[model samples]
Each structure stands twice: as C-alpha cells, then as structure tokens.
Target: MSAGAPGGGSLDPVPEPTGGIEADVRRLAEYIGGTERRLAALPPVPDRAPHDRDRAVAVHVRARRARRAFLARHTETVYGVLTDGLTRPVRLADLVYEAADRFPGLVPTRAQMAAERRFVQAEKEGREIDQGIFCGAVLRSPTAGRHLVETMLRPTPRARTLLDGFRTEGRIELDTVYLERRGVAGHIEFRNAARLNAEDDRLIADLETAVDLVLLDDVIKVGVLRGGTVDHPKYRGRRVFSAGVNLTDLRDGRISFVEFLLGRELGYVNKMLRGLLTAPSPGDGRERSVGKPWIGAVDTFAIGGGMQLLLVLDHVIAEENAYLSLPAAEEGIVPGLGNLRLTRLTGARLARQVVLGGRRIAATEPEARYVCDTVVPAEDMDGAVDRAVEALRAPAVSANRHMLTVAEEPLDLYRAYLAEFAVVQAERTYAPDVLAKVERRWQERERRRAARGSVR
Candidate 1:
C-alpha cells in the first residue's frame, strides 16, 4: 500500500506499515485530518458591522480552543511519530504548516492581527505594546511554523575561528568581557562593571566570541555566564550580573538594528542552541547537540536583555536578592526572545504581567522561581553554581540534555520565533516615533541620575 503525499499530492508508492511506527503515523494523520475538518466547519470571522465583531471573535476563539484541545490530546503521539526517523526531518515543518493550513479559522492568521493589536494598544495607551509581545504573538500563530521552517532552512553566517587571537590555556580578558576555562567548565563573565555590565555592541561581540571559545574547547563540558566586580558606589566590590542592553548606545543611535539581531540571535543564542560545529546527523538529519549545557549565575539583577539571556540557559542560579524585569514596554523597545521563551517557563498570564504590565519579579517570587531553577543567598551563589556545574557534568548529562532539548523545544521553534522577531524588531527599532521615545526616555533617565549624582 502507498501512503498519500501531504496536501493531496499524488500518492507516493511507499512500503507497507511494519505495524510499528508507521501505524502510529497513520493514526496521527487521521486525527489531524479529523480535527482539521472540525475546524473548517466553524464559522469564519464576520466582516459586517462593529456589533458582529464580538460574536465573530468569540466563535474564532472557540474554534481555536477546540483545535488546541485536539492537538493536546494527540501531542505525545504527534511528537513521537515526527521524531521517530520514519520521515525526512526537513519535511516536519511542511507537515505542520499543511496541518495548520487545513484549519483556516484558527485564531485569525498572524498577518491579519499582527499590526491591529499594535495600533489598538498604541491608540489606547499612547504607545505600542512591547515589541516582544507583538512579535511573540505573531510567532505563536498557527501559521508560524511555515516561517520557522524557512528560517531553519536558511544558512547562518560562518563563525570566525575561536582561537584567531587567543592564548591557549589561560585567562583571556577583552575590553568588556572575561573568559577562563577552569577544569570542566568555561566561565564567561561580563566585566563592564562600570556600566553595570550593560551590553553594547562591543560587549555583545566579545560575549559571542567567548561562547565560541567555550564551544571550541574540548575540555569544557559546561559553560557559565555571570558578572564580574562592579566598582560603582552602590555595587562596589560586588557582582552585579547585568543591567541588560546599553541604553546609552541605543539612545545615541550607536546601535544598529542588524547588529542587535545578529549579536543575540545568530551569535550567542544560536551558539547556545546549535552548539559548536555540530551539523545535523545523516541518519535523522536533525541538528546535533554539540553545545555544552549553560548555567547562568545571577547576582543582583538581570534586567531587559539580561533577563532575556536567561531564557537560553539550561540552568539558572540566582541570588536571593536578584530581581528580573523586562521593562521594554516602558522603554519603547522589545525584549529579545523573552516573549517566546518566557511564556514557556512562566505561562502566558504571568509572562504578560511581566512583559506588558512591566512587573518586576523578585528572585524569591513564585514567577522568578519558574524562571530561575535555584535561588541562593548572595554569599552562597558561588557554591550553588559550582554544585550545579558539577551536577551538569555528570555522566550522560550532555546526552540527556540534548535529548530533552530536541524532544521538548526543538530547533525549529527557535528559528520560527527569531525569524518573526527579526522582522518585527527591525520595523520597531527604526520607527521614527520609537526612536524619539527612546531618546526622550534616555534624557529623562540621565536627568534623574544627574540629580541623584549617580550618573555612570
């Protein structure tokens, strides 16, 4: 018997189901088809007067929930069959897209609603919603899988040599970052203490280089990101994790949109996701896990982009007093990747509270616990990180991490999220109003700092 090609293509003659995985695939396809039919039967959004909009939205929401419930019921089966090596991995995204396309009324296509919400929010609140939420909503749309597949299929820029100008077995210090391989873990510390370790273009570049070095080093089994000493009066002689992006550069127009995207998405985050020189395996054609497990050691606070960085980490150890916030809503910018990954940790409601509501999550808060795996006293942070590192370096931990990563998050999700993020952020970053707002806020911040005599 031959299995039909996706999207009603000519039936391709294939081998009969061996009554194992192939049988499972057939069952899953049947379920998907059934769900798609049910979705197709739902009433489409109304195009009439304002009075009908609410009813149309309600109907659409109901259909979306039903679709979600169907997907949930068969999630394990779908994930298992897709990753079972029966079909080409390259076709997975296409399969998801086809399944989604079958149900046209699933929560309104992303393209339709993407700009509407932004405009509505801006009209009501006097400014647009955080770019993170705007972009995240688009990425989470049912049709987003298509965009994600295209992104994963796109080639990444070639990385520079890890040892291009570095010494072999000693501590390496750049202008704004520090790196040292100690035994099984490579420690990459953000060292621009004077700026509260805020990441500028140079700092981002150095951090990416450090990540590459950690990936290139065979002796390194894990990578750790933390902060070095801060000499400012308030944080003198203390570790202060990071204060996120350098707002000064942003306000001064020194940061380019492409630079920010490449540095975060392609540079460090991709390294964290794809690992070092690891290509997809021939058998499964899945991206291999060559990246080491990452442990984030947070002291003080991780704000804005700093908080977003935590999403890519495998484990996070934060100090008791450490707080995390994504104040992009107020800053008139988007927190990179935070919306896509934060919701996975804290759920949609709380993620919204933080991203849209501008809530600051204390380290001891329940939401903070969800984001950080472990919290310790400031003094015990070092010990906790060491223990976590030791635990991560245990036998089979790397393999286990890789398996869980693939089974749970998968590379395509990140690709899809970032692909949308890149476009949306580019638009927001260069918008005349957004730039003006950012600069005005920068001036306000400077004025307040000067009045307090704490300007850095």
Candidate 2:
C-alpha cells in the first residue's frame, strides 16, 4: 500500500500529502483504521514457523509505519488534537495508548495496541497478531517522536519528589545505580555489580533517576558516568565499566521497547544529550533547563551499548587498558544509533569492522582514540575526570556542547534515524536465531564463569 511498506519494492520516503491537512487526516484515519481492522481479522498463524510469522507480521508493521510516517507529514497540524491539546502529562511509555484512546482510525484492536507499545510480555489478549508489528511506528514520526522524547525528559513525579529531598541529602542511592555530587560534578555510578554493570530493564529507572538528579540539581555543573566494581570473580573488585546490554535478560525476554530500549535512548541517554525539557522546545520560549556536559570514565571494556554511548558523551576518558566494540551483528539487534553516529567517529570502513565485524579495539590501538578523548592509566583516571570536569564547568560550555552536537548530527537527523530504527530494532529483537545466539553466549559465559571459580 505504501513505498516503505515491507514487500513493497522501496524504502523510499513516503510522499507528502496532496490534500488539505484536515482532509488528509480524516481520509488517512479512515484508511489506516480500515487497514488495521483487516490486519487484525486475518486468520491465526500461531502454528506457523518463526520466519513465517515474521513475514506475516512484517506486512502489518510496514503498513503501520507508512501510517506513522503519513502522520509525521501532518504532525504540525494533527499532533495536538491527537494528544488532546497537550495538557495531559504523558510519557513515552503511555503516549500512544493515550492518543489511540482519545482518537479513532489508529490501532484498531487491543493486540494492535499492545504491539504499538511493544509490550511483548503482556499477553496478546486478541487473535494471533505479532507484538513487534508496530512497536516503533509512533516513534517513527518526526514531531510525534520528539514530542514523546520531550515528554520523557520532563521530570518524573517520583524524581521531583526525590529532588526536593535530595537537594539536602546530597546523595541518593538505588540498588543498581547511585548519584552523588563530587565537587562540581554529579557522578552516576552504574552498579549492577553482579552483572558487571550490564544494562537491562531493571537498570533504566534508577539510572534515569540518577541522570535526572544531575540535570535538575542546582549545584551540579557537570556530570560523570562510570561503571562500578563487580562481584564476578574474574572482574571482582575491579570496575568493569559496562559489559553492555545484559544478554541473560535479553535472552529471557525481560527487556522491552518503551521501558528499556526507548526508555534508555529517549530517557537517560538522550537526556544527557538534550537536557531536561522543563519548559519544552516547541516555541520561541527558551528552555528553563540546559543540557549538561558529561565525562564518561571507562574501565576494562565498553561493549555494544556502552560503545554506542561514547559517541554522545562530551568527553570520554578511558583507562589505558580498556577496550571498546559494537558487536551489533552478534547481538542480532541494531546498536542504537551507532550505525548513524559511528561513521563520524571512526569513518565508514572502521565503523563497519566494529559494528559488522565485531572487532574489539583496545585503548592502546590508535583506532580507539577516535572514540575516547584521553586514555589514562587506571590510577590517573580520577585526576583526568576531575580535570575534564573543571574544564567543562564553565557556564557557557553547554552552549558550545549543544552546538557541537548539532553540528556533528542535527536533532532532525537523529529523529529521522530513530523513525526507521524503531521498526528495525523491534523486528531484529525478535529474530529467530536471537535466542539461539543468546544460548550460545550464555553457555560461553557459564564456561568462563566456572573456569574463574576454579581458578579462585
């Protein structure tokens, strides 16, 4: 039905609407609603193979994306209406459902609604519809996606409650993440100690809270992100930085799109890039909050997701012995924005090696310099971070930092990339071989774990 729709020959951009905004919205709503209903009423395919199911679901997904992109074309006109005058405080997780509830001619069925939100764990509750079908469709819309991103940036009620108390407490600690003001810097330590600070669903809230504290606090002028020491025998008592996404959780189906994937990118990670959306960025009114510069201190290794993050940080201070890699192929999922950003850092060829080839380049390797700013010995990391903080503490630094980010890659670029990324990542996350790959990785992890225990 559309150009970008799967089984359609092209991934070309959806054409601009030829009709009036109001007329287009009405007509497209009817079309999209009818399409969704037809998709929902299709005969069940639960007994089919994985790829067969995926093929069936992909058609619905592509159609949904086309509808999302169509909405993007008219976002300026229809957005507020769909979102009910923008008075309600809706976060990314709940954004679409609110819209669907408020309006019609969007996702027709409850299962379609679940797929739109990527709630894989929640039972379908309907017929044999695939959950990944429309997971990122809403996010694919430019203004709508940014609106969701901005919504996520608005301080959470819990964070605001913690903030008032945290101002005086000067420190807040959660099970897997903690925030403390160190001089002029708000330091956030990733502390999934038993898992080497690997990222997962459980880490998003606490980590995001820590990030919110830094951006909202009056005293903190700069931010620092680092990994905490882990309990794993091989890396016991040594800060392992980030072992990247938790394969165990990923394999076990514990992760989700809105809560984890979209949550990380639109919540904490992008929060670090764009800052808190206190006043919103829709009009001439300037934002009340400013984006803060962060210095990432890497120890040991930053794999997959961690390496993707290095691209966004203001300064990356890596230990001399540390290394980095973006093994996206092995993980069977896109490495967030790495494909879009890594080329700027390492160029096309090297980026291909890192992302496609899964090449782990150590800090000593000259290629690693492209990703990290200063490689310091483990003992000197604290001093290097302090110096970076002191240098970045200038009030005007954020102005230049945001400018640099835009110059390197505009927000529109990120917006457009994420539109497609939302769909692709959802699809790949459920790839047939992914669980098998995770099983292999799990086996290797256990073998290594056992070997370490024996050595101990």
Candidate 3:
C-alpha cells in the first residue's frame, strides 16, 4: 500500500525541493514516475479480486496523495512545463493525458479520466476529463483553479454558434438546457425534466452553453433561471425548479467534481454571478467580468445544488409552496458552494439550519423571505419574473450591481473560497466510507418506499 521510492522508502508528504525550478521539477517528476510504475505493477482495477482491488485503491490513493501534494507546491512550474508556459494552454480535458505523456507519472490517466460528460467548452475528448479529480488535485494551489475559472469565463465555441444565430432564432434548445430570448429578458430553463432538473455530467456543458448565450447576446439585458416542466408523477406538468445535483448520479459515481462541482461553480454558475468575459484576464481582475443581473424563479422545490443556485441570483421569485434546502447531511458531501455563499443571503444561523441541519425552508416562512425576493402563488411566478426582469434590466442596474458585488463579495474572496472547496469537496467525493453511508441511506429510503407501497 506504500507509495515510496524504489527499495521501500515512503515518499515524504512533500518531496524535498531542489535548488532550481528545473531540479525540483526533475526530482518530483522522478517521484511521480515511480507512482506510474507502481500503478502499472498493480492488478488491473476492473478485474482485480475485491481484496486486491481494495489494496490497489489504497496504493492509488497514496500515489495520488504524493502527486497532488507535489503538484500543489510546484503547480505553476509543473503546469508551465506541461502547457508550454501558456503558449499551448491545454484545455482541462487534455491536461491529464498531456501530463501522463510528458512526465509519464505526473498524473495517472486511470485516476483522472474516471467520470464522463459532453458539450463544446467542457468536453473535447471521450468521457469529459474527470476534472473533479484533475482540477481538484491542483486547485488547492491558488492560481490553477483561478486560471481555469478565468479560462472558462471566456466564451465556449458553442456559445459562438448559438450567439451568432441568437438574434435570428431567438432561442437555442439543447438536450438538457433551453435558452430563449423574450424581449430584453433571456430565460435559461433547466430541461432535465425526467430527472427533476437535477444536475449531472450531461447538464453541465449544455447549461454553461446556455449561460454563455445569455451573456453573449447583446439583445438580452437580463437573465432568468427557471426549471422546465417535469415528467415525475408528483410534479407532472409543473416546473419543479430543481431537485438539486442528482443524488442518484453522485451515489452511482456519475457526478464529476470538475463538471458537477467546479464546472458548475466556475462555469455557468460563476458566470451567472460574474457575468461573461470576452477575453482571458490575467491582470486587473476587476475589469474582467461584464456581468448582468439574473433572476431565479423557483417553482416546486430547490434542493442542494438548486438551492445553491439561488445564492447567486440578483432576485428570486418562489411559488408560495416552494421549499429550498441543502441536503448535505443526507448526501455526505459539500452542498456545492452553500457553505460559502448561503450565509450572505440567510444569515449564519438559518444558513446553518439549511446546510448542516438540512432544514427545508418553505417559501411561506418569514425566514424564507430573505432567500427569495418574492413568494407568490404558483400562478403568479411568471408575472413576478417579468416584473423582476423589467426592473433588473434597466441600465442603472448594471452599475449598481457592480457596486454591490464590490462591497459584498469581491472576486478574489470567491476564488479563495473555491480554492478551499476544490480540495475539501474532492476529499468528500472520493472518501471510502462516505459513499457506503450514502448507499445505506439510499437503501433505507427504498425500504421505506416498499413498506409504504405494501401498506397501501
């Protein structure tokens, strides 16, 4: 289970740094190369016996630990070499393979390419790179995640396809997200009706593309995020807002940290907050994002990621019966950025109830008033969204918004928070006992459903 130098000396948490960047990188590269050989020596993961697989995983964990720790210290130097010092900035999807090819043991392909996805900006290769693993590994270094975030802020190629035709067609409909321009307001509807509008690998790329269209479209002055109608029996014919990040996907190992978590946050989610950037910004971060106001219309419920989405909105309209909660307690993972951003909206105590205690805050509750700008009957959501959009779309609103963002949450503050999240959330995602607990909770829920069915 030990990942150490040859002949059995455990690699220290951080390999010693040699005098120059070249020597340090060389030593670390050699250390990383050893991890690759050790990984190759292990039994193949899929066919291994249970015990063998467990030991293999342990070995891989050690290898990843050493690699991530080394990379954290030498992130700039390592990435500079990997990507040719920005001459050939590798897209996130190609980063790991490039590392594996160049350094051989820097980042293992098996460890990085586990999760999957699609879309223009997010996925280039088969199975969207498990950026959750890749970015999560290096994001603890301040610049790596920030650089990726800034990179993602630039328009995706698909955004150009949609934006070029945006005024002509007035709408771009994708498999998981739909964006349409209505007057000065743009509505981006979450379209995974069959899945209660929960986020997954497939939704991330499409959602960001939709976000990009809204940001890039000159005709649209404001943005609105609402869920589409769902096929679920309970919410049939009704927009359910969102069911959160798909718990089934997370439990089934389908959620990627990069796509689901960071991609969601840094991609469209952050874009929702920071607005669109026309170029990659390396200096004077203040002048980078050209943002517009956004409104969230919550219909039936907003849970976990759905609830996290509300924190970024300039205004929120919720149906009287709608409820929002972050079920981090149940999922045994961070509820995206809830811990970092929720308290700003709901205050510390109430935010803790939603995040830690998993309390569902109904729209009708007095406390819920702070989270949502307006709570009306389900029938009033449209009018509420219209009024909110009209008010937000004014020219003065943009400047005032920048003022608010500057005073409230500075860009670097958000970046620092995500840096912490990048590391902690990754640990939560791959922690051994966490998934077992999640599976057991799922089993218990299924048992309760079965018992209820038998009783009826």
Candidate topping TM-score: 3
Candidate 3 C-alpha lDDT tens digits along 84-155: 765554556566567666655565465445433222211212222223445664555565655655666777
Per-model TM values vs. the true structure: 0.63, 0.80, 0.85
- Position 165, candidate 1: lDDT: 42
Please list the C-alpha lDDT of all candidates, in the order they appear.
0.62, 0.73, 0.73
Give the alpha carbon lDDT tens digit for every residue of 1-456 in model 2: 443233323223423456476566565565555444444444444444565455545545555565565554555455566566665557765655554554454433444544534422222222112222233544555656666656777877778889987888888888799888988899999999998899988788888888888999989999999999999868899998898889887765567665777568877888888788788536631355568899999999999888877888999999999999888888888898899989998899999998889899999998988999999999999999999999999989988887787788776677777767766776666666775788687779889889988999
> CA shift at 105, candidate 2, in angstroms?
9.1
Q: Answer with 2 or 3, whichever has the higher lDDT.
A: 3
Which candidate would rank higher by TM-score, 1 or 2? Answer: 2
RMSD of each: 13.3, 6.0, 4.9
104-191 per-residue lDDT for model 1 (tens digits): 3222233433433343221211111122322333344444433333233322332244453444654678789889888888899999
In TM-score terms, candidate 2 sits at 0.80
Stretches > 4 Å off in candidate 1? 1-167, 279-289, 448-456
Clashing pairs in 2: 140-419
Give the higher-lDDT candidate: 1 or 2.
Answer: 2
lDDT of 2 at 186: 95
Lowest summed lDDT over 10 consecutive residues: which window, candidate 3? Answer: 118-127
